[model samples]
Target chain A: MPSTTATTRRALLRTGAAGALAATVPASPRAQGPARGEPLRVGVMTDLSGPFAGAGSQPLFWGAEVAIELFNERGGVDGRPVQAVTADSQSKADVAINEAERLLGQEGLEVVTGIYSSAHAVPLSGRFEQARKIMWITSAISTAVLKDRNLRYVFRPTVHSDQYGEASVSFIHEHAQSKLGTPPERVRLAAIYEDGPYGTGVAAAIEANAKARNMPLVLKEGYSASAPDLSTLVTKLRRERPDVILHTGYNPDITLFLRQAKAGGLRFKALIGHGAGYAQIDRLTEAFGNDVNYVYNVDPVGTQMLDWSKLGPGVGDLAKVFVERYQAKHRVRDLPAHASMGFNNTWIFLEHVLKPAVRKTGGMSAEALREAALAVDIPVGGTIQGYGVKFAAPGTPMSGQNERAFPVVMQFENARGRVVWPTAIASAPPVLPLPPSSPYAARS
Target chain B: MDPFLLEALVNGVLLGGVFALPVLGLNLVFGVVDVIWLCYAELVMVGMYAVWFLYTQAGWPLPLAFAACLPFVAALGVLLHVLVVRPLLRAPPINQVLATGGVLFVLQGVATLVFSTDFRSLGVEMPPMEVGEVFVSGTKLAAFLAALAGAAALWAFLKFTYVGTAIRAIARDREVMPLMGVDPRRIYLITSAVGGTLAGFAACLLVVQLDVHPFVGLSFGPITFMICVMGGLGNMLGGFLAAFLMGLIVSVGGFWWNTEMSYVVAFVFFIAVMFLRPQGLFAR
Candidate 1:
């Protein structure tokens, strides 16, 4: 009986192996080409019901959905329809890891994207790498994820924290000299960042860049993200009297800082913010109104004030269509930068990587998809934000970082955010020393 | 003393005034009810959302919206007490804390669903009033004065009013209050309503200066709890003084060091006080 059971097991193994080969055989057209209308599944894991839900998750999800809609409207990826399977991570890293596993293993998705918090993204990046799946990070800008991890499957197409800090410093240097008549050395800079990964990374970058440029960093401070008050910090800032203040924090802290600063009579020649709360234009405007005006923020360009010519032909029209459809779908007048970048990067991924991979390999397998992403080299002006898509080589400092991605400096002018740096695409020049009529003008 | 330090100290005291209103109710609720009311800060949060909806969304006048918040939140407090707290009154103290914790999550979840977690602010524009070399914000000063006035009015009521005296008697000994012809349940209900009203009042004062989001309460919730603990649970005057003390320490420490260090110093002070005086600074 034992010998008969062994013989049956061997036969079963041989039969299963043969069946697997038969399924993959070139003779089966259904196996080679995606079934006529079968939708390509891409997972979008984000914090839909957590602390970050309003911050970026909702918009990030909408952004990716808009991209998929655009792709499907244009006869998706080699005529194989693309769809997004969304999972709410609830802004928790462990939940994100579980969602990634379920999406990749149970849902059988080849590519996953959309994580708002670095805490969620970093862990998912490792899981994706281990699983040999592709993860396109849209919003998490922490540098630590790509710093030492040489994960080939993980790719970030958006600007990172370091770039934001560099852009902020550069914007102040250029604008201070040109607008405020203060040179780099003569400028007094202070940095106040939330004591978190995102804030610390950006602050470190700002410090490094300031030192490189010989700028005097008078004060650098860190605070908790959910601090109830910032009056004391504002008092310290007032005493320091820095010419340029670079701040990085989330929504609540940012709102508190500005309010407390107003109360403390803190003003500067150039008040530059590095993304996060400052990039939330509508929220900032709603909270501060004219007070937010004249403040400069360095971040990814939102759907507004885009130079169409900078992006490749036909991409500009697509962006407009995206904005219109997004507004109609979400019923929001303004499309945030998180949503815009999410839409653009996902569209780029679909166009330059997924579709091509499916067409070339005759199937959407994980290895084939990663190879396509690695070979992706969209020239500058190819995407909606005029950013080129090219993942850096593995094992390098820029490991998964997008080399062509750079932060754009935008100044809030007349209750609108206008690009004010990099010369070529600036909508308006930076406003320096804030006019006396401005609410933020120095009292003295 | 340096003018900068003086201004910081003044601002700290003003902040303490704002801080006292919210924590006073928590202290009151805990003192009398013998329940933690963990969702106390969330009640303040709900009041803030009500003000935002009324003033910003519905175009109601700021004063009218603020006034409306009191009744709305007071009703909510009564509902919470009847539905959630009353049943747990017979349960263990831990059960009451756990029940209120559940209420906290539910309130936050409901708030997130309704408000969409976006930061909403009234954007009340008021110019700064220059006091010599120090600039005081009009909104902060108004909030401070309102909070102080609210506290004083409540104190007066507790001192003079018949209902207020009964409530205080209940706080002193719930068992004895029943023997004194005062119904404990009725007094508890009234105390809950009063606590909710105070939270609403604090919310109105806060909304003028801060943005309102779903988790806005969480930002100050822990600190307010700490203030309650430091002041001695159930000791109103002690909590009041503790609030101001914590505010001044945070302000001065933050000025001398950084904001993070300031909080560190506060926690250190809290631990030292807890070790030396386990019942808290003002525990009777």
Candidate 2:
């Protein structure tokens, strides 16, 4: 192997004859038959170098990359090649703003997606609205982005924070109380959260739900995202003797809570997490191991078990092509939520909207593409995740736009970490009573 | 206002003392060596993970795990000095800063690549012991007491021991220490090792309260540095004072305002203090 090389390309100038510079650059055609749908340019901006990079932003980027690759091969968007340029926001709002401007104003990107932190997404929403560019966010579920400043161009593909809380409450009430036979009143709940926007939002929602349901939230604690210790806080939680512990923290905080809870013999009737950091398969296994039994997380669930063939031809054929190519290239099993979400969305947009629009207009201009996307009808007949995607009317986007296919309340059975939720796409019914020493065991 | 609030505040102060332990070590290095040891946070992160592995993974008792880890921290410190610090000693301050900064990133990258980005907390709840009206957890009180005891031990080590005296003398004047037959390079290595060991010692107490992540090092790194500088560079006691002050700011501020706004308040306080005292609150 070659040794590590530390080469600093701080300053490299383009100098020489104008002819040489022009030679190096690819020649551009001045005019093309009134434009026949060129490569569809999409820009992705998200945190890549800050605190939240490893958590989801990087993984989300991989998801989008997979979608673009699949789209390009099977006859690009409406037979026009799709081009994607991704930029890292560095988790800075100002930087995100600047990059969004460049992507919109300079690159003439028709669609923009991917902002991991809500702090960045809130501002980016305004920019996208101004440019009338469509923005599809997979992560960053700040409800504020959806409300108060709702924009026509902005749409979130993944679950929102409010939906997360509501889904969590419903799942507990449905699964924990009825299925697990957990008594409603005896449900002593505690939330260990990081003192940040994400944690606070979930904690507040949980608190409200717990209160309205007449369940006592015995403990409500917040710690720094990078807090080094949780023994004391966990100890206080133990005293409360909560039957259910709802932790709303990032991956590191969750790991600490899991390890320390086991070490201290602080057993709970059910252990549930808000899927922020605990959703990943490897993270859960590594931090808890056998101890992860009965731990349930409310996160994005993919339709892994659903047979794509049942959804009919176009979508099913696309899925087969994607699965074969992806498996061969990456040598991995079926794509996770981060991969499948984008794949399904891209497939929907290309076949249902982009293709017909390009056929009608004879070109893939911004106006033609927008009209096509706006006229999307049969949202869910696709083989991918059974989502049935469609946009809601303006001023009420949440009511209509949220593809019923993806609601974030999937149960991960210990045998195989498959998403079993929304019943329509679930491979199996929610495990009636979480099995012992398995992930859902404690929650049982 | 309530008992929980009081407990959180007291715990914050005690935890703040533990926070000071490593920051104090950084100050010790800064006071004597005049270079910010950016890798000091990584030392703490590694030390906490060391304790986690020894006690949780290796099935050793907590004390044994801590004791076994101290020498490793010291060895790491010595290695850091020989490889990075010593070579950049005669260079410009910026070079020294950049070199140590590089070490910090190298350690963080190694941690991310090897350990994987996951959260780990000591899962067990510490037993709560009542002291008057306030309820304190066993692990937290232990951390608080350990912080106090460690601080006292550090003070004694710097004040009474011959090697400690030599270190202090070198801090005052590196050139003057040559008369006492001590190599400046050797003294620096010893001081850094001492600082690293102190960080390790602090970590054992830290994990007792929270779990350690590779990135937790970066979290505490800048905050502790801020505490050290705000308290007055090279003043160990001032670092302790500043930590508590910042701790109280976060705790009490969080109590009154929303938790999110508390950080903003702390930064405001820091800026105000900086404006008032140009150099710092207690700069030597």
Candidate 3:
């Protein structure tokens, strides 16, 4: 149930075609910086026609499109407008590898960006590193993409999965005292996740962070994301009665777990979720409505939720424009966080890396972009998502990762997520224990 | 008994009940037509999309949506048999399997093209009821009962009605039935439609319990076929019993160890059952 009424997807697609048309309309020849020959070509690769299309890839490209469009409006990179050539990743790993070859090799695009799955990013980054082309990763957050891989060509300004675990556990540690009436170390915790790279990675973090702090780790298990039954898992949880549960799963499994847990009478004081499925709040809201309220999810802060005043002077206004363009065209009431990830990360490349590379070298090249990426230094609260750009330098662990990037804990209040953790960026206090109104709320 | 163990057993019975209808539908087709509609689960998937589309998109009431789902999927079953299965009836069994498999792909591809992979639900839920020390999921309980009702109705149809007798007779001896004044072609078509109605029925039950997506059939489809083969391929009663047995093993094993391990244990049991009784556990 995206607010894009079925009719609107058709309407919006036509609008999208027109928008794509408008991007290439050639800025007024007499504008400042003067028009020049041959626009800067960047390949926008994403999952446009498969499983990852709707919730993950489509908005990612839209967000990137917004950033590129705005940059072109402001007279482009020294009057060479960006002309994006898009490719479909199609939710297939093999297709992703092939598309990378096609986009970077046959198509001969130097700077390629926009990835939705870490599965795609992992292989794509490796190929780009070998081929020596600039890949400004807009939004795919697997630690494996950049972890210990000293590739200078690939760069991500988005939060990765490893940071996901730290954010949720850190929130619980800080708030367990006042809200749960329990010491952080004494809290009963359980971790459940889909037995996939993303889920396993996050679950590991949750376990490590909890154990390091001596939190009572009651149970940790992984189930296939497509399991037809979670009743047994629910029964086990009911038996243990964990005070809080850390779960990482895609939307269907999350929906299945919630439905079954309610039916099995499983109760927990609080439930924390990592991004992937949780990024689409509308889906969760459509499934549970008010029952989802007060549930905490960890992801990079949504653009609309951040206190934009602290995001430097012009960044706030740029965010307003991003939201305005994004919401009106996509017809989403509550902006999906992926769109912001698309916009901010792409903005970083356009404003920081691409422009600087072309300016410094008088034209774009992989080595110049790599140098510009390494030299990037934006302090915290610098970008639209309130995280800055600073790629983890080569030879260090997590090369090409924006070390300043971090996820925050947000709770659903009437199905709209409000930041509630990492106190400084938080707009509201963490509603720690589940309120009695929730069907799964523990009976005190 | 440990309450947890009791709950696990109850959950198994409930799980089996939902599993039974799909098994019953696929078994019905395998038994009567002698051709396994390998795309059987995809029919259920289509029916699920129909129910979801009617209820959520078309603004129909839940019951009306479900009512529409049966006939809709039944017709799809008829269409499938007419377009795909009918021509392959005279072909090799492998060719038939391949054709049906193609239908599975076509159905999945079309669903993906139309719906994408976003999981849709009926947004329906039922509370858990306490029976003494154990908790029973009311939604599952109701689905289980509905499944039993579906199984019973199918049994009654095959056992009592004139067409049912012809179907059973045809299933028993396909070559001999044609000489006995019963048109095998008509019966196959009728059975195909009936099998479809059963899929539609199962889809109704599953839509409430599980989310509907294009690849959802992958989750339960293999397991259903396993139950069918383990229950003697086309034996309705054997499939019925085997479904519960598989469900119990999955549930209790999961209770003992973990979800993935439980499935491993179920597959192992299926294999063991095959080795011990090659024709199937209850084939005789």
DockQ scores of all models, one per candidate: 0.34, 0.19, 0.41
CA shift of B205, model 3, Å: 0.6
Give per-residue CA lDDT, model 3, range A306-413, as digits (tens): 877878879999999999988877777777788888889888988898899999898878888889999999998788998877888889988899989989898887
TM-score of each: 0.91, 0.75, 0.90
Predicted candidate 1 versus true structure: per-residue lDDT over B1-284, tens digit per residue: 78788878987898798789988999888888888889988999999999999998899998999999999889888888999999999998888887888788678767876787788989885777777667777888888888889999989989999999998999999987799799999989999999999999989998888788878887889999999999999999999999999999998898888899999999999999899997998887
Candidate 3 residue runs with Cα over 4 Å from true position: A1-41, A48-58, A72-76, A79-95, A101-112, A123-125, A130-136, A358-368, B91-98, B271-281
- For model 1 chain B, give the 10-residue run with minimal summed lDDT: B125-134
Candidates in order, interface RMSD in Å: 10.8, 6.5, 6.3
* Per-residue C-alpha lDDT of model 2 across residues A1-444, encoded as one tens digit per residue: 001101110001111112322232224432221122476666766655445655555455555555665555555654475556666664457767876887788777777767777767778878777887777666766666766554677766556666666666656665666765766655677877886667767788788887777777888877776654454565466557776677777665666666545544465666667755665544455445555644566665554545766775676666666656555644544344544555555555556656777689876555666666667766554536566656555667453245444455555544235554554555656654445554223442
Q: Which scores greater on TM-score, model 2 or model 3?
A: 3
Ranking by lDDT: 3, 1, 2
What does the lDDT read for residue B171 in candidate 1? 92
**Model 2: how far is A30 from its true place, Å?**
33
Residue A176 deviation, candidate 1, in Å? 3.0
